[model samples]
Target chain A: MTGGAVADNPGRLYVNDKKAPESLRDLRKIEEALQGNLGRAREATVGIELGEGGAGSGVIVSEDGLVLTAAHVSGGVGDDLVIITADGERHDAISLGLVASTDAAMVRIKEGGPFPFVEIDADDTARLGDWVFSLGHSGGYDDARGVVVRLGRIVRVADVTIQSDCKLIGGDSGGPLFDMNGRLIGIHSRVGASLEQNMHVPIREFHRNWDKMLASEFIGEGPFAKKPEPAKAYLGVAAEAREEGGVEVTRVLEDTAAAEAGLETGDVILEIDGEEIEDMENFLEVLKGMEPGDKIELTVLRDGEDKTIEVELGER
Target chain B: MEKTRQSKSSWASARGLLTAAALGAMASVSPAQQLEGPYRLNGSAVLQAFEPLREVLQSSSAVLLDDWKSFAYGLVVSPDGYVLTKASELADRDEMAISIGASKFTDVEVLATDVEWDVALLKVDAENLTPVVWKDGEEVTIGSWVVSNGSTSRSRRRARVGIISANAREIKGSSNVVLGIVLKTEKDQIVVEDVKEDTGAAEAGLQSGDVIVEAEGKKMEKREDLLDLLGDKEPGDILKVRVDRDGEEMDFEVELMERHRVFDGPQSRNDAMSGRFSGRRENFPRVIQHDIMLSERSVGGPLLDLEGRCVGMNIARANRSETFAIPAAEVQAVLERLLEDSR
Candidate 1:
């Protein structure tokens, strides 16, 4: 963030400083507001144990044990997990729906109700420079360490993410980010290398997908999505850059397109469908756009002669 | 991996852009937008507004330096030129001095030190210094607004604002203390796999085939039983260990050491991201955990509440989110003991 020129306060506080306190009195007011709601917030924050191995954090949003967490932490729909509450009681839970694009996911506890929960920011009024605090079982939950809290300000706000100065790490993902009023404004996502570059799934995204997530349906697509990625087109040959400007096939696996097309291990692939393939990287890029089972012509250099061969791409 | 690396580089470039934009914002004086957020908190206008208040509270603050570079900070605890600071930060420093405004005091004496609290009492030649005003027994609850100081350069400091992030409690060496022995289950017995060289186990003459029988008067039934015993122990703690070496009961007094010192393993990702931390971070008797981003060197100063009352002394920069401070009541007790020892 750029440090703007210090201008006069013109007898009125800027909209940005609405939450960031400027004076001792205002600071005291924020302290009072935060202290009043801190207990409830702590009670809702929970530790999540991934079935595969690692751990993360989440926040209870409903009394029936609806938890809001990062999509990456929730993994896939119906994935079983153990949720440890503030009092150190563990409950069985299953992953619900998730919007992978926003890194937002929901989990429902299998046991019956009356769980501690915090309210999401209903007004969606969180903005830049707003004072916010986050709670998580950082570095995993320990009965001795308990829940850790961090206070910061929203440094940058994006469409689906809000960047805060609050420092978060591996186990802090899926934790709740709250305003001074103890309203959940975001869910902790991934963290950047810089301490101030922590990303959070904005509360609005959860609000938008509230219905879909409740129905236990996984939605959206991205790297974090539970949906399977499309298969990449395979050429079935381990190739390297030749000294003479073409990709030299080091090895050709059997039962593949290259072996079926009579492309030997020593064949130098010069072009793919008339486009010059300079090296191994270039060959991979051309194949990336094409789907599995696509037929293409390969310009190959066998011995001292250039030959054309038609090959069908295979699934990787 | 590629995406996260790209984002990191982008953040670095964005920081470069921020510097350029900041210069541009300053160069053009056409009623630009008023600064807000962290920069505003760091900027002069807001800092200047709190200058008078901070000046009075920070009068007792002292920055210790070596070769004109700040290494640690301290607070004037008495009118007789006594300054208290984090003890471990001054370890192995031959040339130590504190810069008071424009004056540099090179003849600083290490009057006394408290190993448990990691605090030291130093005496300078000067007298009639403004001792910090401590609010004894004041309730510093979580979410309370707190302030600290960061040293930018020699004798130059900035005000840092944050809140009490966690309840004040005793932080034992839950993660740092270690026996320095690799163990494995051999036929349902917790057998020593390997004893690392120069560790407490090796120092106690523990061999590879020795089976741990007892630790600290407790019988070890499994590997976790020994681990559980070590979890409560701290560095420099003496553990009375008894081992069965080929049906021979051999007893040894072992002194435990820090985990990182014994085994130089990879740091936790969070700790690696948290720039620098105090060498002696854990095992405080009682500490007020706050979210103020003070550097490791900037610790040892006073932590003040919004009312300009000194609540505690900053002791350790634990990680990116947590900075531990010795609470006022505890600081008072340690200060008394140190002063008593100094005499």
Candidate 2:
């Protein structure tokens, strides 16, 4: 199988040379890596539908028909879903559960034998600029095209999310993100600022919360689920727009996350976990996704010096 | 080779600093390390791989500045001083400056603009500008590597690399020119069923039950015929509308407005009737769509091929999936027309 090429030499899959391709041979290697993963991913990826109108993508991850998809795609736990495989094979499945904070969900085939599946790279060896491949039933499954493959490099990877440049369209929400070595690394979660800037639920996040998902224990409210106004994570810091870009910390509440993290009042916040913060609005937008107890690193400038402070978020 | 080595080392050092900073107090004794954590490598090390390409392309591009702040990027199309940028970026801004290399020129003049193609030609009274080399007549195969070159917020050249995801294509916008009035065929005659409020039709005293007879000297027997007649016309164009009400024919001169603007709400339900017909017109300039991630300020720059030849001028960040560029051939054609129009 083409997927065996990467497994044959996993050492070569690590792109330690962080430089632009200077020759055709360099590009060919990267292209081959992507194609190899695409071949493997095409078989496991399937178009998922809950009823009339709800559509997304999913990847079969286990031989016993365990599937991984976005939490938003599954909508709610124990819902009946129809999984249409790449060859147009329809299998009845049921959503097990979802981790709404990370948009990771799982489903199990109700009636099935051994299925074509991909292995998750729980090791988290994926790196920035590493060539990654994405496969999904983009624009819904067309009988002519089947699954579409897009190749791009990993842009940003955080504890809860992985960002990549692989362009994803509307029906690709629950697709799989694979590393060059054909190992499943992430699942498509949501679109970021651009099509290239896509958010994915890191496989590591799933591995950490596997027991919860397998037990069908609902962790948080998915995008489609009714919410009871859950308390949001908060940092006791007052921020305002800074003239020199980013947000300046006006005050830090006593004994709160900001105060405990040693964030000073005069520090200008520049980035939150590798994502650039342009202003107060951008800063709030980034904070909105995080939950209480989520540890984040804030890059800030204080009195002509740059410092990175770690803060454990507090509940609102 | 030396430059490549230097860049690699510099990137490695930067990555080291970033890792240390991200780890913060936890760098000395890591939590993931204490436990039997998954074998992992931080992915932040390889972000600076495009620095070399950025350095090369920055020499040929200019930062369009206004009031000491860079607003857009422009491709230096001529050695003496011509710059090509997105026409929309120049909208409503009379005072402009162009920065090439370390020098900035404030005496910039907008030579001409092609609103249909969304391109503008500007000239600066300066010399020694490095003109971009065009990849003329070259086939842009899908999946071929391309780079978007533009100036960063800190006035440094930045490069975003991605594959040519798609070829020349036309996309439709929600807004289209329309003389807002809903029509219904009654007894083989097109009659106005409703005249949208605040629309050109309403403003022109057109009312419901008004029978459309002629438009711009063309006879209208059906709704399609009227739409076909107005298809070639644009917003702000005056239309000599002839209608019959109460068995009496009256003529009204109406100026068309965009359907979305006239409705002043969501997309009109009778968009097919009142909305300006839209789709990819056959005569649109060829464009190359790439998946390069770019902000609005990064657009209007140059899209270069792997060999460092300019393939096109970045026209629009169309949507999430694509950023479009007007091909070099089309840019050259527009440049010639603009030059002729100016002369």
True contacts kept of each: 0.17, 0.04
For model 1, state the Cα shift of residue B14 in Å: 28
Query: Which residue pairs clash within candidate 2?
Result: A128-B43
Number of the predicted model whose lDDT against the real structure is largest: 1
TM-score of chain B of each: 0.71, 0.65
For every model in order, the TM-score on chain A comes to 0.66, 0.67
Error of 2 at B282 (Å): 14
The DockQ leader among the candidates is 1
Model 1 lDDT per residue over A265-305, tens place: 78999999999987544665687678889999999999989
| Span of ten consecutive residues with least summed lDDT in model 2 chain A | A14-23
Give each prediction's DockQ, rounded to 2 decimals.
0.09, 0.04
